[model samples]
Target: MSKADNMLSILWMLRSGKKMTAQQLADELEIHVRTVYRCIDSLCASGVPIIADSGPNGGFQILGTFADSPLMFDAEEQKALVHASVFAQEAGYPHTDALGRAVDKLKRYTNEKQLTQIERHSSGLSVLQPPIDPEQKGRLQCLEEAAGQRQTLRMVYGGSKGDPGTGSVREFDPYSIIHWKGQWYTTGYCHLRKDLRNFRVDRIVSLDVTDRRFERPENFSAKDVLLEQLLPDPAGDPSLVTVRIQAHDHVLNELKQHWLLGHALIERSPGEAVYRLDSTSLHSYVPYFLLPYGKALTIAEPESLVLRMAEVSRGIAEHYGSMLSGLPSE
Candidate 1:
């Protein structure tokens, strides 16, 4: 995460009415204690009213009045919020109409000079440039409606294709819709599986909001579930193959930005830098991720991957070779 992200995240943490120690902040942000303190200093410098108490039970706190007002933001905070709002809007958030109104209201709150400055700066800002499928909007809307009403959703869900009669109609108590890794998912209690399940919005073949309402688990945490199920394990999975990449900083940064698994950053010392890659599906994920990097990266593990890369190179060469062969003889 960037410094600006850390500052805003700290503010959000305090806003939740929980006092967080610097150590707690460091753990959450995956940064050192000194970096957490530095972020706190940056937040304070930016005019955030963060309060620190120095008792054993005490930690950092922010008064709730700031949230109640809803209009307080320093210049940097305003820019960050505006940028986030733009991203959310572009990403087809379920509450797009409300987000649009909120952005307009925020702009109205800005003074003439601030508005001009924001406009001048925002011209260069853009996010969520990926092409969203048209069907995604409908799926998000259905999930949102079900979650809001505490209603169950009856849908035809397509799971991993195995054989005949694999995918089937199912009912689930929709709890929430979450955006993760550029895809939307709905988590709920699946009646068919007799357990909680996360359904990718795009994989839902069809959906209908049902009259049956179900209570969400009081302790249900979407973030916890996502972390447990989605994020690659630190020790690496025994089943999935490990890929090691040696590359320059620019390529590493690009990989980090584009792929979360690539953000591992195993080692960086002088000219020797290495990144360990772990994903749920190595066959599908590795080739797709490495193709764009081309010759910039070197694969250091999993002999299968080296052979796969060779196969891909051969396929590309064959494709071009055939294309050239098809041309009229000179």
Candidate 2:
């Protein structure tokens, strides 16, 4: 047997409470007695409590309490488990109540050393602020339940476009509730629009499960639909505007991860890269997403975005300048 298999077999024998000496274990496994002693040492190093005695009547034994313990995870596995649980709890994963209880139980089962490693690993992971609010949570739960039941739902949903404060109410057949981009959305068959629609759960003012039932399309796949919506058309209008920017590879790589960048390209240099951003709505993309990069970003393209960037910069400078003027300058 290989070294790992030998160690596993030795562990099994010790766990059985037979109290076999190293010589007896070597005889059973047809290996050197020295090899058996080394395997036992390996097991001990992995946190297994294997005890050995030197006297004539004495033999090898495992700690009685540890032998009966059902938990089998090693230190690293325990740490990984704790890290995953804490991440889920912080990320507003659905079924928060049940997950929270399960995580609490997991903490109870972990030892002090394992807990220390968990804390160390978790310190590097961070979930950004403004977690799901109560209204959004309740809406998500309602959508989840409705999707499972395949019940038609009535919702007052706003548009994803400009100033959608007061939206119209409509009936929809709930298909699925999706968690994407740190937001929860429900995709369903909209009776009002007579087509498929995706509604943001946070934007939904009210939701009601109707008594009417509707069958989801036989060949419908939520993943396929989402991919189609997310991935931009590569063969789309060849006349797509190319807006270049100068930024570090790290910043450029971060921008590439966005769903809207599917058709974009990045040309690399020594320490900087020029990004070719292609979007139908440059106005929205530039102000909301690109401007946040500040001075690291420079527009090298059609005069429109360059002017827009300058205009936005001036507006921000004026706004801050006005605020600064209200305070006494030193």
Q: Which residue runs does candidate 2 get wrong by more than 4 Å? A: 1-82, 104-129, 159-165, 218-224, 234-239, 248-251, 257-259, 266-280, 292-295, 321-330
Clashes of each: 0, 0
Name the top TM-score candidate.
Answer: 1
Q: lDDT (CA) for every model shown?
A: 0.74, 0.72
RMSD of each: 16.2, 11.6
Candidate number with greatest lDDT: 1
* TM-scores, one per candidate: 0.64, 0.62
Candidate 1, 1-330: lDDT as tens digits:
788877766766666567889999888768889988998898888887888999899899776686434446766777777788778877778777888776665565455656777777677687846766767787898888888889898888885434324568899988888888788888888899998888888787777888799989898997667665665554565654456666776776666675455545556654334545554455556676688778888777677787787888899889999999999997
**Model 2: ten consecutive residues of lowest lDDT:** 270-279
- Tens-digit per-residue lDDT, 141-194, candidate 2: 787788888888888787442534467889988788776677777787889989
